[model samples]
Target: MRHVIGREEADFVFIQETKSKELSDARCFVIWGDNNVGWIHNKGDEGSGSLLSMWPKDVFEYESHVMGTGYIAVYGQHLKTSYRCVVVNVYSSCSLRGKKTLWEDISKVRQSSHVLAWCICGDFNAVRSSNERKGITDRGEQKSEVNGFNSFIDSNFLLDLPLVGKKFTWFKPDGTAKSRIDRVLVTEDWLLLWPKSKQYVLRREVSDHCALVVKSVEKDWGPKPCRTIDAWLLERGFNRMVKDK
Candidate 1:
């Protein structure tokens, strides 16, 4: 985690499913090694499903607004721009019914706050499209679940940030199944602060899920280059498809 943060030069970070009981201020500083940082950590049920959101105090002064079962809401003011915003870090339940209830709870938070500059990001454990999932699995993403997730986004008036670097965010241990279950969603007001922002699904490491980072691009990185996996080359007509392209 420390290496990723340093390599990415992240100013803020949200970690879900921490699977830890307590995170003291000293431990938080060790994660970032910055004394000027402020963080809010929500302990999970006995070392499982925890959450932590940290940011540079100089960049954004954050105040904890609410602490849900699997989420944390924070109201922050960007010291540089004086822009106030709300950030919700959620690690929703695997059950569809539980997720729906989580969405409803978030909607209420949105209603209570005057700030429309909101950003929600986490492991939703749900997908918006069938294309987001790959391989055989019994974790059937029901239609009602999809509709409820979409409705929550639409009704709340939030926009899903486009993902880059990878198609899937989580994969099975044996690498058979995969799904884009984690993401970052922000309101129009938040987009106004960073219209050129892009979300990148970083490669997975020890965890089953991938790490996501969203940032504004000040310089063009050029178009993404095409590359094919070695496994695909063994498939019949794979060479022909590449030649045709």
Candidate 2:
């Protein structure tokens, strides 16, 4: 967990399925590596699910937050970019009926906060297509669920950002089932704010689901640009071009 965060240099992080009713600042500090983070948490109910959304105070100005049954929406200003936006961290229900309510809840928030750009991200617990799931036990109810999830995205005008690291965000321990249920969906306004934004599916070390990091591609995550002398100045063609100019 720490490795992934460090590697990404994440400004914000959203985690679901915390399964803890109470979280201490000390614990959070350990996970976040400092006290400079501000966070909103929704404790897990019994064995259901929990949510935690964290952002560096230096990078994001904390405003207000809204929390529902399965999600937490944090509204703030991204200091680096000076853009105000809302980030919704979600952990959905396994059943379709429960999931519908979750979707509606988020949609209501979106409608209410229509002016603010939105980044809706987390484990959706649903998929948009058959291709996204494999080796599933429940095929009978899959198609309807797919349609419902898709409809939610379409109705809310959210764009599903392309994933970079992995095709599937989850895999059964025995390698039986695989699905791309976790994702980052953003409003068009949000896309305009961070045009190079994409979600990276990173290593799944301790959890069954892979850690997701959504960031703008400032540059390709590769080796630093190599320093070079002005070798082109030595070329005869370059001298000719300079002379012609």
Candidate 3:
């Protein structure tokens, strides 16, 4: 996964279901390029613990905690996740308590006014709307989960970028349909700072889920030609040679 992503020249990358046992050395080598990289891994067999990792040899002023799966709050500049924004990587559990844990973590971050721009990316493990599902019929319990997810986003004023092409990120190899489980959520302030922000689904090779690429408009220069001809190329001799040919 890291090798493939490295080729894409992505600034930041978030991965879930890494299935690593050790927290210290859980990240793939290729993901850690010449820039900074942050990660939070699930701890324990029951998946109740979390791990955070980063690179680039810069000390980051951060506040992080282990909820259910993992959540890492990073404060740094020119990092893999951002050039001038704070990046939070999270992996929430799929239980009732997990929802509460996620909410608590988010609330803590909101209380901290130090964070200006933020982008939270990971496997939420919960569907937001019925339109996000594929085959599973909305049951009472599922509806409740969806409602909780929507409420969380609404209260936080987060925006889920409109997905293009494939709606569902994960699917059963047996041909059964499923919901769009994985996503990248950004705060209103972050969107305002980067109005051209967008997320793209990368091809899934090793894992069952596809990877997401989130980009900001900080470096956009519109569309431009790749090459240009100098005045010498349009000289009389060059025109005469072309005419002779």
Candidate 4:
């Protein structure tokens, strides 16, 4: 984890399923490779799952945080952009019912804070499409799961950025099952600031799940592809405006 942070030159980090019950400042500083680091760590569900979020204190100004059922969110302003935003670090439940509650919790947080620029990243433990999973034992269950997860992203107006580096983020020990459950999702306002942002899946070192990093590196291809969210079609007068245009 330390090596990845250093090599990637990360300004922020989100770690899920951390087994440690408590994290010391010394360990956090060591992992971040600096004393100037701010973070929030959950007590975890009996050491089975915990989230550790950290950022360079010099880069991002720490304001306040809200600790919900399964997530931790921090509100701060970026020193460089002076953009006040909320970055939610999540470690959602594996079960569908529990996942729904987690989604509601996040939505309420976003609503209460009224901060539109958001960058949510972590192990969702859910997939958005059927193709994202392989060797699934229950096709019916998987389909239902996909629908629920997709609905959450669409209804919240969160953009699931294009993935880079790997097709599957989780691999079974025997290589029988593989799924793309880890992701980084940002709201439309956040996307406007960085249109080319992408989710990068890093190498799985000493862990079953691959680490995910969100990066925005601009590139110019010959003809760019059109990108838009589906919710726009449901808005009143959208169809007429498109036809008139």
Candidate 5:
């Protein structure tokens, strides 16, 4: 995970299925290196799921909104561009009802966020079309699930961000089955801010799911700018502003 983040030069990262109950600050440092990160995590019990969202504090200021075994939403703004957004990371369950609940939960988060711009990305654990899966015939139940997933996306007004790479994001260990169950979705408001941004599915490593990255095409015309720090929040007025919100 550390290698992928560093190589991609990502400002934000969302991870699912961490499968750990707790992660210390030191572990966060090791993963993010010198990025000055702030994070929100949902710790799961042994043999279950966990979710994590981390970003460089210098680049973005974030507040956690919702934390679930399958998802985490962070509302933040890019310090340099001052572009506001709410980013959600998801890792859904295999159970049909669980997947439906996951969709509804994310919809709630989107509706509640003050930020108009939204970006959701992660392993959905479900597909939107028959073409997304291989080595298994699409049964009636599977078709129904696809329709439900598509309806959720449509109702939320999200556009599926195109990925550059192999079609399948996940594969069985024996290579007998594959599916494009991982993806990124963004709202029209977000697309307006970064119309040229693109998402990619990197080659899979140890995990069955492939590594993903989203790169915004917003250009920097000048030198790099300054960053924010925890000290700034210590100011009398700034502290109050945070609390009042």
Candidate 6:
């Protein structure tokens, strides 16, 4: 995560796998920037779920929404994604049957009244394209799964940003190549607002799946030229003219 931050020169970062509630000290380990905000799930006895944490406190207006078992939404704001936006940190269920319920839950969030932009990202655990997979043994199930995910995105009009460096984010530790599962999906409003937004796959240090970082292209404010006038002459003439008038 720190590697990408330094390389990409990002101001605000959203991390999904902190795996802890106390992020006050962890933020320092991730990057040099100050003002961090952490939102973590309540780790119950089950010991299965994910969380969202971020830095540069000014970026996000912190809020929480509990969708279901492991799914949660940690709301944040930024110029990217939409003119008015809320970023969702999602950790979806691994089981295909469970994904059906997860999709419905996500759709409900989309249909909600004030949702201007919905940016969902995390380890989705489902592949969208046949080209995304490797050494495919079971095409039927895989095709069905991809179709389901595509239907979800199409029905919602979510835009999947083009991945930068690495093509595959997750791989079997046993030296088996597999599908690209981890992804970042944005809405039309987000793409329209920041067309240059992108996702990059980072090297895996902790888990089999690599981490993803999404960046919105910042609008450049062109260079400004300094202007100067004779301060003494301007003051004398301006005061005299004003007095006479």
- Give Cα-based local distance difference scores for all models: 0.80, 0.83, 0.62, 0.80, 0.79, 0.64
Error of 1 at 116 (Å): 1.2
Model 6, residue pairs in steric clash: 81-190
Runs in model 6 with CA error above 4 Å? 1-35, 42-45, 79-83, 218-245
Per residue, candidate 1 scores C-alpha lDDT tens digits across 40-119 of 88897885778898888878887656888778888978776798988888898989887998899999999889997888
Predicted model with the maximum TM-score: 2
Scored against the true structure, residue 111 in model 2 reaches a CA lDDT of: 92
lDDT of 4: 0.80
Off by over 4 Å in 2: 1-8, 220-245
TM-score to native of every candidate shown: 0.84, 0.85, 0.70, 0.83, 0.83, 0.73
Off by over 4 Å in 4: 1-8, 219-245
Report model 6's TM-score to 2 decimal places: 0.73
The alpha-carbon deviation from the true structure for residue 188 of candidate 3, after best TM-score superposition, in angstroms, is 2.3
Clashing pairs in 1: none
lDDT: which candidate is best? 2
Clashes by residue pair, model 3: 43-49
By the lDDT metric, which is better: model 1 or model 2? Answer: 2
RMSD of 2: 5.0
Residues 84-121 of candidate 2 have per-residue lDDT tens digits of: 98888888888889899999999998898846588888
- lDDT score at residue 102, model 1, on the 0-100 scale: 88
Model 6: weakest 10-residue lDDT segment is 1-10
Query: Taking the tens digit of each residue's C-alpha lDDT, what string does model 5 give over 31-126?
Result: 778538888778855627788778888778775467765887887787777988888878888888889998988888787667888888888888
